[model samples]
Target: MAEVRDGYKITELGEIPLEWDVVQQGDISVFYNGRAYKQTEFKNSGTPIIRIQNLTGIKEPVYSDLILEEQKYANPGDLLYAWSATFGPYIWNGPRSIFHYHIWRIEINEKILDKLFYYYRLDFVSRELQGKKNGFSFVHITKSLMESHKIALPPLKEQQKIAEILSSVDTQIEQTEQLIEKTKELKKGLMQQLLTKGIGHTEFKQSELGEIPVTWGVASFEELGVFFKGKGIAKKDLSELGEPCILYGQLYTTYKEVIKEIVYRTDIKVKNPVIGYANDLLIPSSGETAIDIATSAALMVDCVLIGGDINLFRPNQSIDSRFVSFQLNSTRKEDLAKLAQGSSVYHLYAPSLSGFKILIAPLEEQQKIASILSTVDAEIASYEQEKAKYEELKKGLMQQLLTGKIRVKVDA
Candidate 1:
């Protein structure tokens, strides 16, 4: 690694060129806090209210009757900082909305700094804070702590240059992600065609799952498999090691469609613990949402302990478990959702799921379909690696360019 350049000096914010200044965050921008908006104040049509959840995911802004001055509202492309319960910096890209109490609308003196540069720097700080968050699900990042941290400020021209260099890498990542999504879509289409019609088939047969090749057959969960329920263990009972166990939450969050490797285990011992069989389809019986309850994965290992709220299906007939696992997650997702019942805490009954329709192909054809999809997955994995490479490069450049350890030339 290159040592700090000759013109740079050591400072609280680390090495920077002599021309740059180390300034506290408070001195540069105002962290204007947002007001508390009441739930009853929500309306059908009014000024849109932006909550932390909306900024984080697919949530759309809710309309609010409460109105604030233009300065209090954030428009598209504004920098937003969330301090409590998921602290991070977000570049607001949606329509105008009122910022919630936990968020701040940062107002910077444009002449003294580059806004995009500050956004990236604060984001870097947030990531560092993640390790220090301890076991808390939510940790508040205080204004006092933020205001005390030092930031290295360069000339306005150089700040812009650094932002440009980093932003270019971000653009490349975005384009690669788009390609990955398109490839995944192509794979999905191929699955729908290949899994049903299959290759080199002439005769067709109509079933509950629509027309499939004559060689293909239709089977219910009960006809092809058996359902087994596991005993429940409290969250406190979980440990890093003892005996390998599968958790329902892990099914929703961690496991792949066809899970060949088990990562979680139970520290507690139970009398006659239910053991999962090889090639068993594992589904979470309880979840917060319908889509979550629809989550399923296949266990490739046998004799592993299964925890409560997990539904396991062990196929009796000769079949490819990987192909069935992919089928349930893709084509049968909607069918399972229709079987799911409830407003919250969506539930999937084992019996109801047992009767669910499943398309079956010859064992050889099933293996072929699984093999093709696996190849596409490998391609997506390669693109993910490319994305990671650019991201790591960007992180290194940010540490160097933001502090002027490596200086950027400004146009005359």
Candidate 2:
């Protein structure tokens, strides 16, 4: 007994505009599965085979000398869907290549539906299905099940308008992401130069670490700071509204070189909780890889709870915490990585870090270097925020326009 609006009607998908039609995915498009390849067929160079990893850009592309049917090859502008491992619609923007069996080359009936609009529709449907999966990390939709899925569609003109609007927002998001990456690259280059060469330094000297500015000196971490380990708290100890907390894993996944804010909290009452201090540097004590354990962030807020598997470094008055963080991430990353030990899970203990040495410039120069890097960090943060907003806007627009909740003007 759902109430329908004046110009809206109830369908299997709840309620949509009266003019919209609910149709099976197969009715409007043909999903051609890509060809499978044997390991022996793989070559060093040939036509690139698109796999689920390629869609996500997580793995290097594998090439094959084996030729496939024309329908198996996806060209630029063709809509593609990854059905296994990862799920989603991707309009192939890469060069014409053979797509793996796990992917589907969607051939839309453009006469009845716009390809880009259907692309967005497929994406929306995938999200909805994923939402209903109940905590599962991933769910694979069989070809028959995917084709049988029902979706509500608007008129061709309305579909085109919705696609155009969403595409514009996507473009904004992509451009902003590109800007963030470029700014980060600039920051990386700056750190490499400033941390080693020092600003306005012409003279250089060689130390156990490497060649550095003459004025700069190397100092063991133990001499610059006192180390302590966070104890007791675990991921299960976290809560939404409680004391702000920092977990060791967050150093690699959440915070940057400088922690401007805290995002997690815990309500669990622990006797004498390990509290963080301003200018205190934090690094993970354990991680999946040695390099990951080497990541560090300078805590700016005081009195926050420091969780277990973390190494907290309280710098002396002479040291710039931010400068030390940037140096650890750039110059001493490998040196610290070499010290990390374990079989499957890497561990970085205070004893290992006690004698770990790093470049130390004059206090003034350290602050100056930190300030320059901080400015770039701020720029990257702003761009990331902009990209997030654009992505959110796109989500809202898709929820409305794709469901006919919001209508756009169409040409007469």
lDDT of each: 0.83, 0.90
Model 1 lDDT per residue over 1-412, tens place: 5576689887776667898998988899888788787789888888888789987885767788775877779988888899888788889888888888899988888989789988988887776667565522456878887777677888888888888999999999999999899998998898788877888898998887899898888988889978988776656777887887888888877786777777877788888788887778888888888876886887878778899888888887577788888887888887788888889678898988988878888888888988888788788878989999999998899877876768888997
Candidate number with greatest TM-score: 2
Candidate 1 global CA lDDT score: 0.83
State the weakest 10-residue window (summed lDDT) of model 1.
129-138
Superposed by TM-score, candidate 1 places the C-alpha of residue 171 at a distance from the truth, in angstroms, of 1.3
Model 2 bad stretches (over 4 Å): 1-3, 134-138
- In order of appearance, the predictions have TM-scores of 0.78, 0.95
Taking the tens digit of each residue's C-alpha lDDT, what string does model 2 give over 1-412? 7678989998898899999999999998999998888899788999998988888976578898877679988899999999886899998888889988889999988888999898899899888888875522465678998889889989999999999999999899989989999999999999999999999998999998889899999999889989988977888988999999988878878899999789999998877778898999998899999888888998899889999899999989989899999988988898889999998999999999999998899999999999999999999989999999999999999999999988899998
